[model samples]
Target: MTPVLDPDTSLWHVIALEVQRQRIAHDLSVTQLATRLRVDRSTVSRIEHGWRKLSPEQADGLDAMWDLQHLFRRLVRFAAATDDGNWFTGLMDFEKEASLHRMWEALLVPGLLQTPDYARAMISTKSADVEAGLETRLARQASVFDGERAPRVSVILNWAAIEQCVGGRDVMRGQLAHLLEMGERPNVNIRVMERDAGAHVGLDGSFRLLTISDREIAYSASPERGRLVLEASDVHDYAVRYDLISNLASPVGASRRLIEQALEA
Candidate 1:
């Protein structure tokens, strides 16, 4: 079954209304629609009321039988993209809408840059459904970061994060190589901050700053919690800190050189 959509988003209302409109237009009662779709009447009722989820197969059946022009199929994707968590939804939405994105990492490779093996090793250890979380993250890279029109991106990695050996040797090497490959893209700038730089403003934490529409927002996540920075002052502070840390990190060319060196090791 597809996941429930966040009612906070207008898309949720649109989908519910669409389903109801289709049923009424066809002069079909909830029971008739449910029977036609081979689902329980309660399922059809829940879909119209936005209380339960409609499975993708069932949605496609609705679309095919009702001649929805693939509308339900598309709406199913929107519902699948959302879940019941505030932690990932906000930043993900910002990423979709943002034109520019910058991030710094002190402990582990940033999610956007991780290889599947590395990401699987990390996320599976934390979440109940490791495969689901891992695939979701990988899917985000394709949908949000891989295109030419994707957000102009920059990332600074602490030397320790690169050297810590999170997923063992082979996975780490693949990840490093992937970094160099992604860095070659015009829109992606990946850098490494040598521990030698020692004691910079970013010592406080890792944060991500994004340019959304005309405004800037920042986010910080820790093992304990995550924070969304909305105040202009706070967002500016992170941007300033990012600039300082980027200065400390090796420049793109030298950064790729560092990654190459690590790949050799």
Candidate 2:
């Protein structure tokens, strides 16, 4: 039995399958389709396998070649623009699929790195069912951090987020210890923004920049709502903001020392 592709999880997979289907229906070989799209045959294969996304130029070429009057173009546009509003389904999909994740958190530890107790303390106050919420939060970490090919993650954590005790001394100490362990992983980098750094763009809120397939996405969250940003320009701005905030953060070694100091304090 063939498994079904979930469009909500990855619109790229849906688009890829559709392009392959269109090519087959038109009796075009992969090489021939590549020629039409002005991309390499490997590019075509990558697109079909959902390892790569169709660029706007490739989308336009497909529409022109098929004379389908912008069918592919519209799919690409919609895929880039699609978001799930408050549900954050789209944001979660991006987090799972992204090859690289860059995050800046001002008020608390990012969910991807939160400890179970810390997550419970945070989630319990805002929502019902602490056990269910804690389970879900831990599941999210497993998906993103425990994968065979875990994504490279770089985090800029505000020092205040560490000093502010959420779950009590034991919980805070455990969380900081966890952070140190995670930082030791080759794929993870943790940099701390000292509380004294005083006033920066990241102070506006917490956000993430995710690099997935051929594009970058930005996600910003408020109390109960989140937004997935796909506009190239907007995503670029987030990238730039991340760079600026990173400038204010301690180096990885220094950050580790800071965490250790906090742990001993």
Candidate 3:
């Protein structure tokens, strides 16, 4: 049965429903389809209900089962080409299958390690719709611990990010401590670009590089609008810019010291 459309149904949901239709049209039951896809029945149900995203492998399995090899390949290509929807939703989907994440933040603490207070302050300051914003941000943070394989993440923050004092000294202290804890993880690297480091490409804004298999997609945020995902030549240019910014940024050791100094101040 086709699921009723709800305001919350995303593009992923539409795609999932299409897959289900094809399966049923081919006389395949949910269990048979799940077995063919090598995923649990609940996984199939979640994907259909838009409660979960399909990995590239799972998408491929469904494509083959539904005799949609060409269309499935195209959908996967589109998924790889862009970072997808809302910022938080896109982050969850990207992190799920990414092998590496390259990030830069100019004005605020990166979301992954933000304390509740800091996150609250950020949302309150920026979001016109605070209630929805808070829920989305919190949900995004929760996804970091969901998957079995976490991506290797490298984040570069502007020194100004530490000095801003978003939620006051005590909150800043908690945030700095959180950063220190997160940096100690074997798969994560954090760096800070000093204020007087001279001009750099990242001065424009913050952006992310998400590596899915052999392809890398880029996303940037705008103050007036929302997020924009980059592809092809645009992704390549942002990558070059990111590399230049990283080069100008302080080394990890110095960055940690900078954070410590900010916390003390």
Candidate 4:
């Protein structure tokens, strides 16, 4: 089943056609193609239908095997940068579709990891439509808890996020308790970066990395500068920062203990 390729808004469809055209050029059937590429037949189907976005590895592998002149990689990036306005809207869409969601939150609790009360308190300061924004933020958490097929979630939290009482003691108590519950999920890994993990790469600020199919995009911001960076270089830079923070963070067990300790205090 082939879908119409809207070339303007759908550079992703352009990639699908390029992959299909090249596969047929080589006279390989879907099953044959999957066998030859060592990927699942379903993967090929999804790519052809634009139902799944390609990772850089998948794109590069296809390029090397089929000689597609690197057009595949360029198109994948173009698709990621499709929307210029409402960065959060683009991010929410990405979060919904991403196979993996990861973040190094330096100052405040991440939305997906926040309790409704904590989120309400945090948003109250900036969001004019507090009720709608709170609902949207809470809804986003659904991505992390969708049964066994839920996206993998890894959150590295700065110790300050736990210590600060964003919505006073009762709200923080709920938030920490919620984190403890989320951390126990098989697909969720929560780590804490201690205050003494000073002079780390994450010292710059907080950022989120979403892995869609195989490619990853990152969002980072500060009061002075904020951006949704789509380039491989931008993603690569965050990955490096993430690694450094992870290395210094408390182990999962220790992180949970820290949360428990904070709850008691």
Candidate 5:
């Protein structure tokens, strides 16, 4: 038997294809599988296409249905861990299949739209073992626009991010300009939360919520805590926090003016 590919290394598209193949071999139509899984046919299709992630319970069901108990266990473990390498690999899987990405940045601009100069400055300040962080950052951004499945992203940045001037005047200016350009895209949305905004949960740090179909996963950074991956209940909490932050954030039109003002200043 050929060795089974590690789901972490395989693209999400490939994973979905394998799932579809197994379902077919078992003589299961989408509706039939959905009935067994207690979900809608479209939900089954989304899972098979990697447009939705399997929760732990769903993974267990899949394992029994496909005789993949071991593989499913490994996938659940991978999802629960904080390994940056593994986390990034999983992110690549989602990036390949996700239809939308919703993110909140309290510290700096999110990685996907960072300019090279801005990226270098941010990476230079980090103590991470990873060298060429800037290069990797750029590559991730390129991936977003590279293919047909390019994610529709909505990013909310804190007003303080613009005021902090991570890379000084020239670089900050360029970054703001880049944000302006990226915001013009049909699939991208940019907003800013003002300092005066009262009581928002995301004031602590940056977090991202990636959506595939209707399933969402949350990720956050920590020093002692490391990378935190939240699903199910935790995912819902973070989503609520995101909504609160967005409510207090500047509107899109106002956010544009604020960026313009920062550029002028």
Candidate 6:
């Protein structure tokens, strides 16, 4: 049986449900719908499950097929107009529930591994209440790192992020020391990607893949905002990217030595 999407989740969810409903009403199988859209079968599945956004072109194709007078295209525009500024908020909730986390950061320490001072230094530029945001970040770290039920975490961080001072020398030293300490935990693994490795796949950006309950979620962020990805195929791509990054990273022991070297330098 095909699962139904809860229409109230988001406008995209409503669009997905409508697409699925129209396809079924016209006696079309998923494969048939995919053929009509000139997209892969998996694309149709992702759309129906609200895991992927319906693209403008795909919406036009569907509207033409069903003679819906561009209804899907109009819905897509409306969904695009609404700013999902709460994506990071959603990420916080997912992080608390995730059982396994694989993260890759090219420029800075991952937030879960940041010292309060380091976190504050970055948060202060964007937030009106630095202390409040700092408190929330500390709480998030405690939830993921201090508890017995803490998730298994693997991090691949660029060496430059360790070498470059954040929050001045004292705070940078504390952050490095904190990373070394966190790396000692049995459930946490940290590896460093050397700057000398030339260019690599991770140079594009930072991303994290999390396993929550039994489902996988991926997140990629820019300075403006972050996006939460739920499509299985897209999440798998992130997993593969993580593996590629791990290949270029130093082993945990070597990474520890690198951190120790930076602390001394």
* lDDT accuracy of residue 227 in candidate 5: 46
Please list all clashing residue pairs in model 2, or write none if there are none.
none
lDDT of 2 at 59: 91
How would you encode candidate 2's per-residue C-alpha lDDT over 56-145 as one tens digit per residue?
899998888888877687567657755323436666656777899999999898999999999999998988899998887887888898
Q: Model 1: per-residue lDDT, tens digit, 1-265? A: 5455454664556677788888999999999998999989998888877776667798799889978776687566555654444445667656776788899988888888889999998987778898899888887787667656778988899887778787889999998888888898888888899879978888788889989767898998787567677669998988889989887888888888888988999
Name the better of 1 and 4 by lDDT.
4
Query: How much lDDT does candidate 1 score?
Result: 0.81
- C-alpha TM-score for every candidate: 0.67, 0.70, 0.69, 0.69, 0.68, 0.71
- For each candidate, the alpha-carbon lDDT, in order, equals 0.81, 0.86, 0.76, 0.82, 0.75, 0.88
Q: Model 5: residues >4 Å from true position, as ranges? A: 1-86, 127-131, 223-230
Which residues of candidate 4, in runs, are more than 4 Å off? 1-84, 223-225
Q: Tens-digit lDDT track for model 5 on 49-148?
A: 6677556677688888788744564465555443344466556556555778888988788788888888888878764734568767767777777776
Candidate 1 matches the true fold with a TM-score of 0.67
For candidate 3, write residues 30-54 as lDDT tens digits.
8887888877899888777767766
Query: Candidate 6, residues 146-234: lDDT per residue as tens digits?
Result: 77787999999998889888889999999999999999989999999998988888999999999977678899978888788766999
Error of 3 at 128 (Å): 6.0
RMSD of each: 8.3, 10.0, 8.1, 9.3, 10.3, 11.0
User: By descending lDDT, how would the candidates be arranged?
Assistant: 6, 2, 4, 1, 3, 5
User: Residue 158 of candidate 1: its Cα lDDT?
Assistant: 89
Q: In model 2, state the lDDT of residue 246.
A: 93
Which candidate number has the best TM-score?
6
TM-score of 3: 0.69
